[model samples]
Target: MRELDVAKLPEYVEEDVRVSEWSTVRVKHCAYSVPSRLKGKWVRVRIFEDKIEVRFADVIELACERLIGRNLCRIDYRHVIWSLIRKPGGFARYVYREEMFPSLVFREAYDGIQVLQAGTKGDLEYLRILHLAASTMEADVAVALSLLQMAGKAITSDAVKEMIASSSTSIDVPQLVSPAVRLSEYDALLTEVAA
Candidate 1:
Protein backbone atom coordinates (compact mmCIF):
# COMPACT_ATOMS: atom_id res chain seq x y z
CA MET A 1 0.00 0.00 0.00
CA ARG A 2 1.02 3.65 -0.53
CA GLU A 3 0.06 6.91 1.16
CA LEU A 4 0.36 10.68 0.67
CA ASP A 5 1.23 13.46 3.08
CA VAL A 6 -1.78 15.73 3.04
CA ALA A 7 0.15 18.11 5.27
CA LYS A 8 2.08 19.79 2.45
CA LEU A 9 -0.69 20.83 0.06
CA PRO A 10 -2.28 24.13 1.04
CA GLU A 11 -5.73 25.40 0.11
CA TYR A 12 -6.50 27.32 -3.11
CA VAL A 13 -4.73 24.56 -5.03
CA GLU A 14 -7.71 22.25 -5.22
CA GLU A 15 -11.30 21.87 -4.09
CA ASP A 16 -10.48 19.13 -1.62
CA VAL A 17 -7.69 16.81 -0.49
CA ARG A 18 -8.38 13.10 -0.59
CA VAL A 19 -5.78 10.89 1.04
CA SER A 20 -5.74 7.33 -0.23
CA GLU A 21 -3.37 4.50 -1.05
CA TRP A 22 -1.08 5.82 -3.78
CA SER A 23 -1.85 2.75 -5.85
CA THR A 24 -5.53 3.65 -5.84
CA VAL A 25 -4.90 6.83 -7.82
CA ARG A 26 -4.47 6.97 -11.58
CA VAL A 27 -1.35 9.12 -11.96
CA LYS A 28 -1.51 8.81 -15.74
CA HIS A 29 -1.80 12.59 -16.06
CA CYS A 30 -3.51 15.65 -14.60
CA ALA A 31 -3.97 19.16 -15.85
CA TYR A 32 -5.31 22.46 -14.47
CA SER A 33 -7.07 25.34 -16.15
CA VAL A 34 -4.88 28.21 -15.03
CA PRO A 35 -5.51 31.83 -15.89
CA SER A 36 -3.52 33.36 -18.70
CA ARG A 37 -1.48 35.44 -16.29
CA LEU A 38 0.06 32.30 -14.79
CA LYS A 39 1.08 30.55 -18.03
CA GLY A 40 4.81 30.18 -17.40
CA LYS A 41 4.37 29.94 -13.65
CA TRP A 42 2.05 26.96 -13.24
CA VAL A 43 3.28 23.93 -11.34
CA ARG A 44 1.90 20.70 -9.89
CA VAL A 45 2.68 19.00 -6.60
CA ARG A 46 3.67 15.34 -6.22
CA ILE A 47 4.48 13.22 -3.21
CA PHE A 48 7.80 11.40 -3.12
CA GLU A 49 7.77 10.34 0.50
CA ASP A 50 7.13 12.26 3.71
CA LYS A 51 7.44 15.63 1.94
CA ILE A 52 5.87 17.16 -1.17
CA GLU A 53 7.59 18.63 -4.18
CA VAL A 54 6.45 21.39 -6.56
CA ARG A 55 7.36 21.12 -10.21
CA PHE A 56 6.59 22.75 -13.51
CA ALA A 57 3.86 20.81 -15.37
CA ASP A 58 4.21 17.85 -13.05
CA VAL A 59 7.59 17.07 -14.61
CA ILE A 60 10.30 15.76 -12.28
CA GLU A 61 13.10 17.86 -13.75
CA LEU A 62 11.56 21.07 -12.40
CA ALA A 63 10.99 19.45 -9.04
CA CYS A 64 11.13 22.10 -6.34
CA GLU A 65 11.23 19.73 -3.40
CA ARG A 66 11.89 16.16 -2.41
CA LEU A 67 9.76 15.60 0.62
CA ILE A 68 6.43 14.11 1.66
CA GLY A 69 2.69 14.86 1.28
CA ARG A 70 3.15 17.67 -1.25
CA ASN A 71 1.64 15.75 -4.13
CA LEU A 72 -1.90 15.82 -2.72
CA CYS A 73 -3.26 19.12 -4.06
CA ARG A 74 -6.32 20.69 -5.64
CA ILE A 75 -7.09 19.96 -9.27
CA ASP A 76 -8.38 23.42 -10.14
CA TYR A 77 -7.29 26.84 -8.86
CA ARG A 78 -10.15 28.67 -10.64
CA HIS A 79 -12.89 27.71 -8.23
CA VAL A 80 -11.36 29.22 -5.09
CA ILE A 81 -9.77 32.17 -6.87
CA TRP A 82 -13.11 33.11 -8.39
CA SER A 83 -14.61 33.18 -4.94
CA LEU A 84 -12.14 35.86 -3.78
CA ILE A 85 -12.07 37.93 -6.96
CA ARG A 86 -15.87 38.07 -7.01
CA LYS A 87 -15.88 40.66 -4.21
CA PRO A 88 -17.55 40.89 -0.78
CA GLY A 89 -21.09 41.29 -2.17
CA GLY A 90 -20.55 38.34 -4.56
CA PHE A 91 -19.90 40.70 -7.50
CA ALA A 92 -17.25 42.89 -9.11
CA ARG A 93 -13.46 42.69 -8.84
CA TYR A 94 -11.61 44.88 -6.39
CA VAL A 95 -9.20 47.10 -8.24
CA TYR A 96 -6.36 49.04 -6.66
CA ARG A 97 -4.57 51.63 -8.71
CA GLU A 98 -1.06 52.98 -8.38
CA GLU A 99 -1.21 56.37 -10.10
CA MET A 100 -2.25 55.29 -13.64
CA PHE A 101 -1.40 51.65 -13.03
CA PRO A 102 -3.97 49.29 -11.52
CA SER A 103 -3.93 45.69 -10.33
CA LEU A 104 -6.33 43.24 -8.68
CA VAL A 105 -5.98 41.44 -5.34
CA PHE A 106 -7.00 38.20 -3.59
CA ARG A 107 -6.99 37.21 0.07
CA GLU A 108 -5.42 34.09 1.62
CA ALA A 109 -7.73 32.96 4.39
CA TYR A 110 -8.81 33.43 7.99
CA ASP A 111 -7.34 30.33 9.64
CA GLY A 112 -4.15 29.83 7.48
CA ILE A 113 -2.34 27.23 5.35
CA GLN A 114 -2.29 23.47 5.90
CA VAL A 115 1.22 23.23 7.36
CA LEU A 116 0.59 26.16 9.67
CA GLN A 117 -2.84 24.96 10.75
CA ALA A 118 -3.50 22.76 13.74
CA GLY A 119 -6.34 20.91 11.98
CA THR A 120 -8.90 20.92 9.18
CA LYS A 121 -10.34 24.36 9.92
CA GLY A 122 -7.11 26.19 9.29
CA ASP A 123 -6.04 23.87 6.47
CA LEU A 124 -9.32 24.34 4.67
CA GLU A 125 -8.91 28.08 4.59
CA TYR A 126 -5.39 27.77 3.23
CA LEU A 127 -6.65 25.25 0.71
CA ARG A 128 -9.18 27.81 -0.43
CA ILE A 129 -6.44 30.35 -1.01
CA LEU A 130 -4.16 27.88 -2.77
CA HIS A 131 -6.92 26.54 -4.97
CA LEU A 132 -8.02 30.06 -5.88
CA ALA A 133 -4.49 31.16 -6.60
CA ALA A 134 -3.60 28.12 -8.70
CA SER A 135 -6.74 28.39 -10.78
CA THR A 136 -5.75 31.69 -12.30
CA MET A 137 -2.53 33.19 -13.55
CA GLU A 138 -3.38 36.64 -12.20
CA ALA A 139 -4.58 35.86 -8.67
CA ASP A 140 -3.27 37.82 -5.74
CA VAL A 141 -2.55 34.46 -4.11
CA ALA A 142 0.08 33.71 -6.78
CA VAL A 143 1.97 36.89 -6.02
CA ALA A 144 1.51 36.26 -2.31
CA LEU A 145 3.02 32.76 -2.67
CA SER A 146 5.91 34.16 -4.66
CA LEU A 147 6.52 36.79 -1.99
CA LEU A 148 6.37 34.21 0.75
CA GLN A 149 8.96 32.13 -1.11
CA MET A 150 11.47 35.00 -1.30
CA ALA A 151 10.85 37.66 1.37
CA GLY A 152 10.43 35.07 4.14
CA LYS A 153 7.41 37.17 5.14
CA ALA A 154 3.89 37.77 3.81
CA ILE A 155 2.78 41.03 2.21
CA THR A 156 0.82 42.43 -0.73
CA SER A 157 1.91 42.20 -4.38
CA ASP A 158 3.13 45.77 -4.42
CA ALA A 159 5.12 45.12 -1.28
CA VAL A 160 6.48 41.88 -2.77
CA LYS A 161 7.75 43.76 -5.81
CA GLU A 162 9.66 46.07 -3.53
CA MET A 163 11.23 43.10 -1.74
CA ILE A 164 12.10 41.33 -4.99
CA ALA A 165 13.80 44.45 -6.29
CA SER A 166 15.79 44.66 -3.08
CA SER A 167 16.71 40.95 -2.74
CA SER A 168 19.38 40.99 -5.50
CA THR A 169 19.52 37.18 -5.58
CA SER A 170 18.59 37.07 -9.30
CA ILE A 171 16.59 33.97 -8.52
CA ASP A 172 13.32 33.18 -10.19
CA VAL A 173 10.83 35.98 -9.56
CA PRO A 174 7.99 34.02 -7.92
CA GLN A 175 5.35 35.39 -10.26
CA LEU A 176 3.36 38.55 -10.96
CA VAL A 177 0.72 38.83 -8.22
CA SER A 178 -1.01 41.94 -9.31
CA PRO A 179 -4.11 43.34 -7.59
CA ALA A 180 -3.68 42.81 -3.91
CA VAL A 181 -6.12 40.38 -2.38
CA ARG A 182 -9.15 41.86 -0.69
CA LEU A 183 -9.66 41.89 3.06
CA SER A 184 -6.70 41.31 5.39
CA GLU A 185 -5.76 37.96 3.90
CA TYR A 186 -2.19 39.23 4.03
CA ASP A 187 -1.51 37.36 7.25
CA ALA A 188 -3.05 34.19 5.88
CA LEU A 189 -1.22 34.50 2.56
CA LEU A 190 2.09 34.81 4.32
CA THR A 191 1.37 31.88 6.57
CA GLU A 192 0.47 29.46 3.77
CA VAL A 193 2.83 30.74 1.08
CA ALA A 194 5.32 27.95 1.61
CA ALA A 195 3.19 24.88 2.03
Candidate 2:
Protein backbone atom coordinates (compact mmCIF):
# COMPACT_ATOMS: atom_id res chain seq x y z
CA MET A 1 0.00 0.00 0.00
CA ARG A 2 1.21 3.48 -0.83
CA GLU A 3 1.77 5.96 2.04
CA LEU A 4 -1.17 8.33 2.45
CA ASP A 5 -0.35 12.04 2.24
CA VAL A 6 -2.17 13.53 5.21
CA ALA A 7 -0.99 17.02 4.28
CA LYS A 8 -3.35 17.16 1.28
CA LEU A 9 -6.49 17.02 3.44
CA PRO A 10 -8.13 20.35 4.12
CA GLU A 11 -7.89 21.56 7.72
CA TYR A 12 -11.62 22.31 7.86
CA VAL A 13 -14.69 22.01 5.67
CA GLU A 14 -16.68 25.14 4.94
CA GLU A 15 -20.48 25.20 4.64
CA ASP A 16 -22.84 28.07 3.99
CA VAL A 17 -25.82 28.43 6.33
CA ARG A 18 -28.37 31.12 7.09
CA VAL A 19 -28.59 32.57 10.54
CA SER A 20 -32.04 31.85 11.99
CA GLU A 21 -34.40 34.28 13.67
CA TRP A 22 -33.14 32.87 16.94
CA SER A 23 -29.71 34.29 16.07
CA THR A 24 -28.15 30.90 15.60
CA VAL A 25 -26.70 28.74 12.84
CA ARG A 26 -27.19 25.01 12.75
CA VAL A 27 -24.42 22.58 11.94
CA LYS A 28 -24.46 18.82 12.27
CA HIS A 29 -27.75 19.05 14.17
CA CYS A 30 -26.21 21.43 16.70
CA ALA A 31 -26.97 25.14 17.02
CA TYR A 32 -24.44 27.88 17.68
CA SER A 33 -25.13 31.48 18.46
CA VAL A 34 -24.17 34.31 16.13
CA PRO A 35 -24.63 38.04 16.40
CA SER A 36 -28.30 38.98 16.11
CA ARG A 37 -27.45 41.39 13.32
CA LEU A 38 -26.60 38.37 11.20
CA LYS A 39 -30.09 36.92 11.48
CA GLY A 40 -31.58 35.84 8.15
CA LYS A 41 -28.17 36.41 6.54
CA TRP A 42 -26.04 33.74 4.95
CA VAL A 43 -22.75 33.04 6.70
CA ARG A 44 -19.87 30.69 6.04
CA VAL A 45 -19.30 28.10 8.72
CA ARG A 46 -16.02 26.24 9.02
CA ILE A 47 -16.46 22.94 10.78
CA PHE A 48 -13.52 21.54 12.67
CA GLU A 49 -13.58 18.49 14.89
CA ASP A 50 -13.61 20.46 18.12
CA LYS A 51 -15.01 23.84 17.08
CA ILE A 52 -16.83 25.87 14.47
CA GLU A 53 -15.78 29.18 12.94
CA VAL A 54 -18.45 31.55 11.65
CA ARG A 55 -17.61 34.12 9.03
CA PHE A 56 -19.67 36.90 7.53
CA ALA A 57 -18.74 38.91 4.44
CA ASP A 58 -15.41 37.07 4.52
CA VAL A 59 -14.73 38.35 8.03
CA ILE A 60 -14.51 35.91 10.90
CA GLU A 61 -17.07 36.96 13.50
CA LEU A 62 -17.39 34.11 15.98
CA ALA A 63 -15.64 30.92 16.98
CA CYS A 64 -17.28 28.45 19.35
CA GLU A 65 -16.57 24.93 20.49
CA ARG A 66 -18.69 22.40 18.64
CA LEU A 67 -21.61 20.74 20.34
CA ILE A 68 -21.56 16.95 20.11
CA GLY A 69 -25.17 15.80 20.29
CA ARG A 70 -28.27 16.33 18.18
CA ASN A 71 -30.28 19.48 18.93
CA LEU A 72 -27.61 20.60 21.33
CA CYS A 73 -26.89 24.32 21.44
CA ARG A 74 -24.14 26.69 22.51
CA ILE A 75 -25.38 30.19 23.12
CA ASP A 76 -23.46 33.30 24.05
CA TYR A 77 -25.48 35.89 25.94
CA ARG A 78 -23.83 38.79 24.16
CA HIS A 79 -25.02 37.56 20.80
CA VAL A 80 -28.71 38.20 21.55
CA ILE A 81 -28.39 40.66 24.40
CA TRP A 82 -29.67 43.70 22.57
CA SER A 83 -32.72 41.94 21.30
CA LEU A 84 -33.40 40.55 24.75
CA ILE A 85 -33.19 44.02 26.17
CA ARG A 86 -35.93 45.13 23.82
CA LYS A 87 -38.11 42.11 24.51
CA PRO A 88 -37.37 40.75 27.93
CA GLY A 89 -40.49 38.59 28.01
CA GLY A 90 -38.77 35.91 25.96
CA PHE A 91 -36.08 35.28 28.55
CA ALA A 92 -38.02 32.78 30.64
CA ARG A 93 -39.51 30.80 27.77
CA TYR A 94 -36.64 30.89 25.29
CA VAL A 95 -35.84 27.47 23.94
CA TYR A 96 -32.25 27.82 25.06
CA ARG A 97 -32.97 29.95 28.10
CA GLU A 98 -30.47 28.34 30.44
CA GLU A 99 -27.60 29.00 28.04
CA MET A 100 -28.07 32.74 28.49
CA PHE A 101 -27.03 32.54 32.12
CA PRO A 102 -23.28 33.15 32.07
CA SER A 103 -22.62 31.99 35.59
CA LEU A 104 -24.22 30.48 38.66
CA VAL A 105 -24.30 33.90 40.26
CA PHE A 106 -26.41 35.23 37.42
CA ARG A 107 -28.71 32.25 37.66
CA GLU A 108 -29.02 32.80 41.38
CA ALA A 109 -29.83 36.44 40.81
CA TYR A 110 -32.60 35.46 38.41
CA ASP A 111 -34.06 33.07 40.94
CA GLY A 112 -33.94 35.68 43.63
CA ILE A 113 -35.63 38.20 41.35
CA GLN A 114 -38.35 35.69 40.61
CA VAL A 115 -38.97 35.18 44.29
CA LEU A 116 -39.26 38.91 44.84
CA GLN A 117 -41.29 39.67 41.72
CA ALA A 118 -43.23 36.92 40.03
CA GLY A 119 -44.18 36.27 36.38
CA THR A 120 -43.13 38.57 33.53
CA LYS A 121 -42.04 41.27 35.93
CA GLY A 122 -39.31 39.04 37.28
CA ASP A 123 -38.25 37.96 33.79
CA LEU A 124 -37.95 41.56 32.65
CA GLU A 125 -36.02 42.49 35.77
CA TYR A 126 -33.58 39.64 35.30
CA LEU A 127 -33.16 40.55 31.65
CA ARG A 128 -32.21 44.07 32.65
CA ILE A 129 -29.63 42.74 35.09
CA LEU A 130 -28.33 40.50 32.30
CA HIS A 131 -28.12 43.52 30.06
CA LEU A 132 -26.14 45.38 32.73
CA ALA A 133 -23.76 42.44 33.10
CA ALA A 134 -23.36 42.31 29.35
CA SER A 135 -22.77 46.05 29.09
CA THR A 136 -20.34 46.22 32.04
CA MET A 137 -17.95 43.89 33.80
CA GLU A 138 -19.82 40.75 34.85
CA ALA A 139 -17.74 40.33 38.02
CA ASP A 140 -18.93 43.71 39.22
CA VAL A 141 -22.56 42.80 38.64
CA ALA A 142 -22.06 39.49 40.40
CA VAL A 143 -20.55 41.23 43.38
CA ALA A 144 -23.48 43.63 43.44
CA LEU A 145 -25.89 40.71 43.41
CA SER A 146 -24.07 39.11 46.35
CA LEU A 147 -24.17 42.34 48.29
CA LEU A 148 -27.85 42.87 47.57
CA GLN A 149 -28.65 39.34 48.69
CA MET A 150 -26.59 39.68 51.86
CA ALA A 151 -28.20 43.01 52.67
CA GLY A 152 -31.70 41.52 52.36
CA LYS A 153 -32.52 44.10 49.75
CA ALA A 154 -34.83 43.55 46.81
CA ILE A 155 -32.80 42.23 43.87
CA THR A 156 -34.41 44.26 41.14
CA SER A 157 -32.81 45.57 38.00
CA ASP A 158 -32.91 49.15 39.28
CA ALA A 159 -31.27 48.02 42.52
CA VAL A 160 -28.49 46.26 40.63
CA LYS A 161 -28.05 49.32 38.43
CA GLU A 162 -27.81 51.53 41.49
CA MET A 163 -25.27 49.22 43.13
CA ILE A 164 -23.12 49.13 40.00
CA ALA A 165 -23.26 52.89 39.70
CA SER A 166 -22.29 53.37 43.34
CA SER A 167 -19.35 50.93 43.24
CA SER A 168 -17.81 52.47 40.08
CA THR A 169 -15.09 55.04 40.74
CA SER A 170 -15.50 58.52 39.35
CA ILE A 171 -12.42 60.35 38.05
CA ASP A 172 -12.28 64.15 37.92
CA VAL A 173 -9.54 65.11 35.47
CA PRO A 174 -9.37 68.66 36.88
CA GLN A 175 -8.31 67.31 40.26
CA LEU A 176 -5.15 65.74 38.80
CA VAL A 177 -1.97 67.82 39.24
CA SER A 178 0.27 68.21 36.22
CA PRO A 179 4.05 68.26 36.65
CA ALA A 180 5.67 71.66 36.14
CA VAL A 181 7.91 72.18 33.11
CA ARG A 182 10.17 75.24 32.56
CA LEU A 183 10.81 76.32 28.96
CA SER A 184 13.73 78.48 30.24
CA GLU A 185 15.77 75.32 30.99
CA TYR A 186 15.61 74.30 27.33
CA ASP A 187 16.80 77.81 26.28
CA ALA A 188 19.76 77.55 28.70
CA LEU A 189 20.77 74.19 27.18
CA LEU A 190 20.60 75.73 23.69
CA THR A 191 22.80 78.69 24.81
CA GLU A 192 25.39 76.34 26.36
CA VAL A 193 25.56 74.26 23.14
CA ALA A 194 26.06 77.44 21.04
CA ALA A 195 28.83 78.69 23.36
Candidates in order, TM-scores: namely 0.23, 0.82
- lDDT score at residue 160, model 2, on the 0-100 scale: 86
- The residue-by-residue lDDT of candidate 2 on 1-195, one tens digit each, is 998776666779999999999999999999899989999999999999888899999899898788899998888888898898788787778988999788888888888888988888888888888888888988989999999888988898888888888777564456778889999999999999999
Indicate the residue-level lDDT of 145 in model 1.
56
Candidate 1 deviates by what RMSD?
A: 22.9
Off by over 4 Å in 2: 1-7, 170-195
**Number of the top candidate by lDDT?**
2
lDDT of 1: 0.37
Model 1 over residues 1-195: C-alpha lDDT tens digits? Answer: 789656854432322222221101212133222232333443454554333444444443222223223333223333224443333332122221011011233333222233454454443444344444354333444555555745555333334444445543556777877986576687778879967
Instruction: RMSD for all candidates, in order, please.
Output: 22.9, 3.9
Candidate 1 Cα outliers beyond 4 Å, as residue runs: 1-112, 134-140, 154-195
In terms of TM-score, how similar is model 2 to the real structure?
Answer: 0.82
